[model samples]
Target: MSADDTDFLAQRFEAHRGHLRAVAHRMLGSAAEAEDAVQEAWFRVSRSDTDRVDNLGGWLTTVVGRVCLDMLRSRKSRAEEPLDSTPHGAPPSPAHAAPADPEQDALLADSVGAALLVVLDTLTPAERLAFVLHDLFAVPYEEVAAVVDRTPAAARQLASRARRRVRGADVPEDDRVRRRRHREIVDAFLAAARNGDFEGLLDVLDPDVVVRSEAGVTTGAAAVARGASAFGSAALTARPTPVSRHALVDGAVGVAVLVDGRVERALRFAFVRDRIAVIDIVTDPERVARLDIAPV
Candidate 1:
């Protein structure tokens, strides 16, 4: 392709970049990996016969979906067990971590709270790709089938099965009472964490829960329970006065630990079936300072 031809194609690709990123992120559950997937799509798009592609957007979306599906399959093959076997709850280097996005954070909290990603992890790669494309992105079933290399009928079935599972595990986002219940459950969890009650935590936590903190990521109910026990030691004094407040951290139900009006730690909890599935604690100074924490 000529220089100007390549430039024009690049500009056209840029138009779909944000959308492609969103699609890939939903499929892969990591923004970084999504970028990589999108980049790969761009490479394929650039080299492919553009004339033969009647619909550029649809073609690129399919390519990205196929790339993500392959990646997911490779990851699954390498794992000792299933995807839920280990949540990516490991401690992060805040200094090196990408700048926080409150909108994305809130969305993630919602996704995790509803166990959307956890449930998505359970789905077969074809089913996941089919569902995410057709259901989430409004891609037609025919296109979805093309991406997954399945018949249109099989694609519809894949999406149907995925939809049923997601609906079962999904939280009621539309219900005001359900929202209130989420806050109350999280508040109780915070109290339990403060009181050094391991069993209490276990009561609220899912069997395969994960907790991420400055110390490290704690996976499994037993380890998370032990960490809950350790948290109470510091809560004796550091959390004395008002205790912790249940607030909306970045527009999601989260607990904020304050020391004299300053947020010391932000606890973002994801509830699955009204039980805690993931606990992400952010103690980084810069990120904590950016939180929009308000009482429930």
Candidate 2:
């Protein structure tokens, strides 16, 4: 390509940089690695003649997917085990350490939750690529097949396997253990609430924890602690004692309040650094009925 042509290609690549970066980050779970993959894609694309290329965006996405797949495979070969096997609260191994970057942090919080990232890390490179490209980004399985060097039907199966893992089906042993730990924390919180232990509630809650309910929003540990203690007292005095059971509310550790063996209320929790950072109380009968409550 001539200088002018090169410049034009650069501009086009810049136009798709944001989307490409998002794809790579979701695939590799590292901002730095994602940028490297995009750069590699540009190098490969720039050298090739694209005069016949009809869909520039689609072409670019496939090239980036290819680059990310190679990077993920490289990482996998060097690592001893899947990331999900890492014990909770343990420092990440070097192969898995993503630099602390604000942009990557924002990307994680916006695109995929931290928990989902952990699950994704357990997927094989081809599986991750198939799922991230076809399932998440809406790339056709045909394109995904070309990128992963698999038949279209085979590519679909890869994404299907990945989808089940990401959805908490066929989970790894350690991942199940992590979920158990999260349940333990929820159990502690519920126990504290039932006993009217103010300090106990605060122990598991983040200092700036926020609770949202049908009634209203409450912020801060002290405020939520007070509400929890009050709820506990009310539960004790109210007829047909309310029973709190640890259950999976929307695939996360949560508490379901049962009155006379029927779920009447649910508390969905979002954890930050193993502390309860947010609690969504679902009391609306319709909403509560819609929740996918399952035994943990």
Candidate 3:
């Protein structure tokens, strides 16, 4: 291609850069890796002849999807830490990282919830690619199949499985309702404790409930209630006001305590009917970070 032709192609590629980056980010869950994937796609596209390609945008999207799929599969094979291994609250390194962009980060967090990223990490590369491209981006199954090397029907199935996992399809509709109710009970118990309402806390706790933590186990409703009151008191006196929010802990309703906008710990619960039968406190930083947490 002549200089003019090359410049024209570059402009066209630039137009699709943001979209391609979004696709790669959703697939890879890392800004750095997404940038690498988009750059690789540009390299391939610029080297190829596109004289007869009618839909340039569609063509570019598919190219990026294919690039992302390869990156995901390679990541799986390597069995290494994710490319975006910045710990939950650590600042990115200035020497090796792109300039900070809070606006873009917030947009991505809104577009793809942290919980969804956790679930996507559990999917196979093919399934993740099929779901993100076809379900999220409205790419046709024909194109999805081409990218994942599966039949259109197979590609459809891959996305279906991924969709099911993302939506917690393993849980029945009735069970889901019950889970929500459990969350409400948990929330109420926390509220009561925060306000030092012993009766309200007892109303949501099973008589034989067991509470386990790194400190030790506290059994019986009355005993647990007293402990919860003390816990709440501590939160009230802490330097920063603590916030309790419900989140999904290993696919079930649970509570997370946030201090200064970071998850300090989590409380996983087991229910006997409508009341909380067990409370397992997770304070280990690593374990807390791995929990499947999302807004309730």
Candidate 4:
């Protein structure tokens, strides 16, 4: 409240905002929710008496942990309610799946990816909070325990369970290997599709290859020809031109599209065993403005 107190809080926020956001995002899987949790934590910190707290960092972290846990618990309860209670013919689009261009996709893939977030969502709130804080952020068990209101041993157990679940799922290899394979697969797939070489594209595709679009479209290898046809048709209508053939999205290979020398689209590929396992295309027109992408 006082100038000195305000300055101290401001300094703390500057020092720890990134760390807080990382922990919250990993737990909740929503940047918007993570930001809200951080703001709520700050509000609680401001109302407290700082003089009584010896370790301000630890105190703030605990506040954030508690806030995130409370939010997760509320969400879980809603999920458990009867379906009729919550109108649900079809799920709404995920918030994170905004239409993205090449630049936006490139930037996002490095910091966060859809596959990784899906794995994180399998965890319970407590497990997510404990694991992200202790494993990802390297926060100690004792400190993390305080945030989740659990004993250190219990927090350690929660994190362990969460770690096992994540590790059990398949993860792409190191950045370098992932990128190399991604480029190889994307190039092969595109070339084959362009030439109407179904066998060529099939050869490069994994047996279970999947393609997803931000528009809620999904297709597998069995339907790849149809999917590719749709994409090709749209490409013609949109008059897409390649701005850059090779770019990295989170260290994975991506293709950039430009219209009038400005970035208009970005497509990222995921590879498995030297085959194209997944392809993500983002065509959100707004992404150009949000990412400040320059036209080729």
Candidate 3: misplaced stretches above 4 Å? 79-101, 169-296
Please tell me which predicted candidate would have the highest lDDT against the true structure: 2
Candidate 3: residue 229 Cα off by (Å) = 51
Q: Which candidate number has the best TM-score?
A: 3
* Each model's Cα RMSD: 16.6, 11.6, 18.0, 17.3
The residue-by-residue lDDT of candidate 4 on 23-100, one tens digit each, is 666667666666667767666666677777787777777788898888888886676321121123322212213332
Best to worst by TM-score, what's the order?
A: 3, 2, 1, 4
Judged by whole-model lDDT over C-alpha atoms, candidate 3 comes out at 0.75
Q: Local error of candidate 4 at 5, Å?
A: 2.5
lDDT of each: 0.72, 0.76, 0.75, 0.63
TM-score of 4: 0.48
Candidate 3: give the clashing pairs: none
| Cα displacement (Å) at residue 76, model 2 | 2.6
- Per-residue CA lDDT of model 1 for 1-296, tens digit only, reads 76566667777777777668778888988766776677667666666667677777888898899989888889876852222211243222112234535585455445533356788888999988888887566587889999889899898889878866765575555545666878878767767877888888888888989887776877998887787778664732255453577776644568887788777888777666677777777888886785556676
Going through the candidates in the order shown, the clash numbers are 0, 0, 0, 7
Clashing pairs in 1: none
Q: In model 2, what is the error at residue 174, expressed in angstroms?
A: 18
CA lDDT of 182 in candidate 2? 75
